[model samples]
Target: MPIRTEIVSQDRIVYQGDADMVVLPGIDGVMGILPNHSPVLTALQYGIITVRLKGEEYYFTVAGGFVEVQPDQVTVLADAAENVAEIDVARAEAAKTRAEEMLKEGIPSDQDRYLMIQAALRRSTLRIDAVRRYQQGRRSRG
Candidate 1:
């Protein structure tokens, strides 16, 4: 059986198609969905979302969102979302370095800035993980 999945952000629809399974980063924890799943809705936290279709896999980094699962469909609406192919490795690396520097500074007096930096770190790390996995696949094929 095939399950329909869609990933949407505030500004755009990042992905939409058929999938065999989906692993989502939920607020409470990670959740997996397959065809004919019971309907449910849950808040999302900053993390990665993985979708499997046929024999292929796809990955996306999402910064918070809500997921709704119906009998045959899964929809994720995120504050922001990016796929591995869409990620800029250089930008993600820079953000990771900047976040590390901010953390080393002891978070200072700005709580919001600290949290923002932390979120950036998480997002960047997710991207890096996905990209690295893709690179590994390329290496094996080469």
Candidate 2:
């Protein structure tokens, strides 16, 4: 049986569909959810989320989030999420560069702002890498 999966970011639902299996970047490590899996509620780290159906696979980049897994459904509530195919490489690159420049100037007095920049840097890097790995046909199982 396929598992129903939904990935939602703050602004919108990034994906909603049935998948053969879903792989998540759990805080403990990667976790794979299949139909009839045990229930779980876990925090997610900055990484990739993969959904497979039949022989096809879909990849998404998630910056941070939480996932709820039930016997037949998986729900991801993300801070930011996007399909690998939809990632704007140029924009990611630009963000990365900007972040790097900011970091080079030294940490901001506001620790929160520094942390946000760091998170942004990580997210942009993840997006760029996901596009390079998945969109370029280097599809290894996530």
Candidate 3:
């Protein structure tokens, strides 16, 4: 039996499918969930989420989120999330650069602005890394 997995960001549902396994970046560490797994509710860290079905896998970059796992379903409510295949590497690199530049220019007077920039840096970095680590093979194959 496959688990029903849904990954939803603030704006829309990024992915909804049945998977043999789901790996999440939990706050404490990475956790893998399979069908008929015990229930869990946890905060997620900024990292990659992996969904495996059959012999294939799909990857997504998630920037902070909450995951609820039940015996037959896993739902992710992410602050921001995107499929690695959909990511624009150049765009992510540019955003990472902008965030780094802002930080190097000196901390912002507004704390919220600083946090926002940091968050952007984290998200962009996660997206870039996810693509590098997971999307390359798919691209080469295609």
- The C-alpha lDDT values of all candidates are 0.84, 0.90, 0.90
Model 1 / residue 40 / CA error / Å: 1.1
Candidate 3 residue-wise lDDT, 104-123, digit = tens: 99999999999999999988
Worst 10 residues of 3 by lDDT: 133-142
Clashing residue pairs, backbone N/CA/C < 3 A, model 2 = none
- In model 1, the Cα lDDT at residue 15 comes to 88
Give the least accurate 10-residue stretch of model 2, judged by summed lDDT.
133-142
In candidate 2, what are the lDDT values of residues 1-142, reduced to their tens digit? Answer: 8999999999988889899999999999999999999999999999999999898888988988899999999999999998887878999999999999999999999999999899989999999999988885433332
Q: Rank the candidates by lDDT, best first.
A: 2, 3, 1
Position 93, candidate 2: lDDT: 99
Q: What is the C-alpha local distance difference test score of candidate 2?
A: 0.90
Off by over 4 Å in 2: 137-142
Q: Model 3 segments beyond 4 Å from truth?
A: 137-142
In model 2, state the lDDT of residue 11.
92
Q: Report the lDDT of model 3 for residue 91.
A: 98
TM-score of each: 0.83, 0.94, 0.94
